[model samples]
Target: MPDASPTLGEAGAASVSPTAVLTIYIPSEAPQDKVTRAIDAILAAHPWEVPVIEVSETRLVMCG
Candidate 1:
């Protein structure tokens, strides 16, 4: 018989605290309003603390 257990990434994983920091990455092509609405909906469901959002287009580039 196999050991029936849920992995860390499974649904049994611990839930995140509302005050925990959230990091979201929006694709360049995604609509800002739509993304904002989706984020708002998530926040509304969990009621998290005000997040530190950083929006940048060039942050992922290498300057070497």
Candidate 2:
């Protein structure tokens, strides 16, 4: 399941703690190269210290 937990950032916090968790999704139908580039750009722009980033159909869940 995707992360349905409430997040501090989403609650309008001024800053996110280093341990805050976030979820992102890329639909399977999306272009692979575009997905790669988009993820790369996100990494370049932010200092996300996530321990793991899984990209598979099993975890391809997203909420509208």
Candidate 3:
């Protein structure tokens, strides 16, 4: 069957504000470990504490 889910590129088009809960959908095949490691490295190298990163595979629906 054809994929029915929206792609990361499409989902990212939505506005993301600090006051709002923004959900980012990344590819399942992506190397999450590497991404987290990179993020950790950046945080360690910098002085700012990065926001909490919650990872999960769940379906999301948006109604207008």
Candidate 4:
């Protein structure tokens, strides 16, 4: 499975930026319903207006 943690990188600023690109990986063994629910939960928790959700067979990328 791919790491679900946020990938930390510098954004060429003097201070460390909080802006992050989160990528969630859902395994093949995981059910589609569960994955959907998880994604929903994450979105609800964050509640970002312009969040980007890119879904593929193996991964989901949520960027704000």
Q: What residue runs in model 2 are displaced by over 4 Å at the alpha carbon? A: 1-17, 48-51, 59-64
RMSD of each: 11.8, 11.5, 17.3, 13.4
The lDDT values for all models are 0.59, 0.60, 0.54, 0.64
Q: lDDT tens digits, residues 1-64, model 4?
A: 1322333433333334365688877788899799889988877866444357788775557999
What is the lDDT ranking, best to worst?
4, 2, 1, 3
Q: Following a full C-alpha superposition, what root-mean-square deviation does model 1 have from the true structure?
A: 11.8
Off by over 4 Å in 4: 1-18, 58-64
Listed in order, each prediction's TM-score against the native is: 0.40, 0.46, 0.33, 0.50
Q: lDDT (0-100) at residue 43 of candidate 2?
A: 71
Question: Across residues 1-64, which tens digit of lDDT does each residue of candidate 1 receive?
Answer: 1332422223435544335556677788898899889777876765324344566664576788
Tell me the tens digit of each residue's lDDT in model 3 across 1-64: 1332332223325433434344566666779797788657655764323355577887668999
Positional deviation of 32 in candidate 3, in angstroms?
Answer: 3.3
Q: What is the Cα-based TM-score of model 4?
A: 0.50
TM-score of 1: 0.40
Error of 4 at 21 (Å): 0.9
The model with the greater TM-score, 2 or 4, is 4
Clashes of each: 0, 0, 0, 0
lDDT (tens digit, per residue) of candidate 2 on 1-64 = 1333334344333554665455676777888899999878767765534334566664546899
Better of 2 and 4 by lDDT: 4
Residue 39's lDDT in candidate 3: 59
Best by TM-score: 4
